[model samples]
Target: MTRRTFLRAACAAAVPASLGLPALAQPAAWPARPVRVIVPFGAGSGNDIVARLMGDHLGRALGQPIVVDNRVGANGSIGADAVARSAPDGYTLFVTTNTTQAANPALMKKLNYDPIKDFAPIGRIANTPAMLVVNPSLPVRNLQELITLAKSRPGKLTYASGSAGTLVPAAMLTHMAGIDMLHVPYKTIPPALNDVVAGQVDMMFTDMATGMPQVKGGKVRAIGVSSLQPVASLPDVPPIAATIKGFELLAWYAMYAPAGTPTPIIERLSRELQAAVNHPGLRERLASLGLQPVSSTPQELADFSRSELARWGQLIRSAGIEPE
Candidate 1:
């Protein structure tokens, strides 16, 4: 079957007739009150920024206030767990990234919620390539130079990681280059990027939205982008794949609700989300932050999540990162 046909069938099978609710309890007049969107990151992090932007448009479209709540920690697990346990009545939504739904399953030994089972897919929001940035004092001008310095110093160099998106790429660099660097973990990206700016840490792979400002301010220098090809936002920076063959990763955002949410509710939210991201003003705003705004159907998001789980799992294992 064609991919589109397959997705249609999968979505049909995945969504139940009543979504486990008594026919009378399906919230006939759905979204009767303000909806809360839980963001599993710190306030100034990329996920939080995107969540608020989308929330503003979505709230206006739905004629209800959209509340964005930042519940940070455990690589996004703390907030994810809250959403998982919330009422599946379409009131509590999750605006999160692959870190929580895909990489955490592979990186953590145990999780409170099932990435596939505990949440109903809403739709994808956007995608942004990460930038390999370092402190100005790191003495590396480009990817090749960083690789050389890393190899020479071995364990002396250190990289900071606040989430799986950053952590996975850092681990991939070590695995591909046969180099060793100390891994320093943080609760969120801003602080991790802060230390890199202060020269407490040597480098980090951060999303363009969070890292670009520091780069522009000269607090950090971007060596390469974490995509197979250079991104339009950073036209002059080369792709890290140019130095490390086949190295590519992109941080993405998506929305979800607790599992068993009514199919009608899920579909309506998905449509609104698609429209919100496609809004002309919102699109321009996202572009300014180096994010590519793209939306997907609920089924498409589900399929993508499954694929990412497997893809990131393999990469993590290859990097010799043990689950914790």
Candidate 2:
């Protein structure tokens, strides 16, 4: 090669280097437009609340507005599939709860997308425990009494569930405790909880956010929490594991982008999510909703996703829950 031509090529390469710009500095140019954060649930739901909370700060951090698109249906499958099919660009993100990612795989025979492979995990946001609640008017006061009564009546007692994930915990409890209870499914917990408060259903297992309100209002009686240990917010409430040893069921939220998103983008999202969860107001709001903020690295989230998928799959198979 001629020396002049070689020098020209060398200068071309050194231009960006001398300017202190990396080859991938274009990430700094990201968000030249607004980003969309899709939540696969309706408004007023726990997932929706968290998504908005994270989006608000994430928008400020990225210097762009983070729009929360709620496309609720098919137990969050529709919105989840949309995010899975979106471009792998960092602009489109999915803020999802366990219902779509973990429970739906076993509950549905054919999902539009594979939870683990279809998207890149950004980070885990929170884990919320479900409260085992019963109508205050019931003769049974505690979990043991309720189980004993259900055993005596077999399928006479009925329990309500808002979704497959919510039901699976109760189903697992019935199977493990050797009791049979009729299942009453609802579109969401608010309605199911309304029925429970009115004594239409004998019992139900709902998230602390929904159930605690009723329990405090004298609408329902909280028997136990579906956590290995009691939560700080409900210190008096016993852990279900205390009565049914090893009984534990909880739901978690995570963030993801379409598979093949750049690793730098994933890292950026994870950092922003960690920061959002660490914010004092967001942390307090999550705690008030009975959700404990938990931020995990991408690898850590991947491992958690795998473990949860396996655990819930095993429970579904053992309980003989057929896909719809």
**TM of each candidate vs. truth:** 0.90, 0.85
lDDT of candidates 1 onward, in order: 0.91, 0.86
Off by over 4 Å in 2: 1-28
Q: List the residue pairs that clash in candidate 1.
A: none
Model 2 lDDT tens row, 188-237: 66778789999999888887766766788888988889889888887888
Model 1 off-target regions past 4 Å? 1-28
In terms of lDDT, model 2 sits at 0.86
Lowest summed lDDT over 10 consecutive residues: which window, candidate 2? Answer: 21-30
Q: Residue by residue across 93-113, what tens digits does model 1's lDDT show? A: 999999999899889999999
RMSD of 2: 5.3
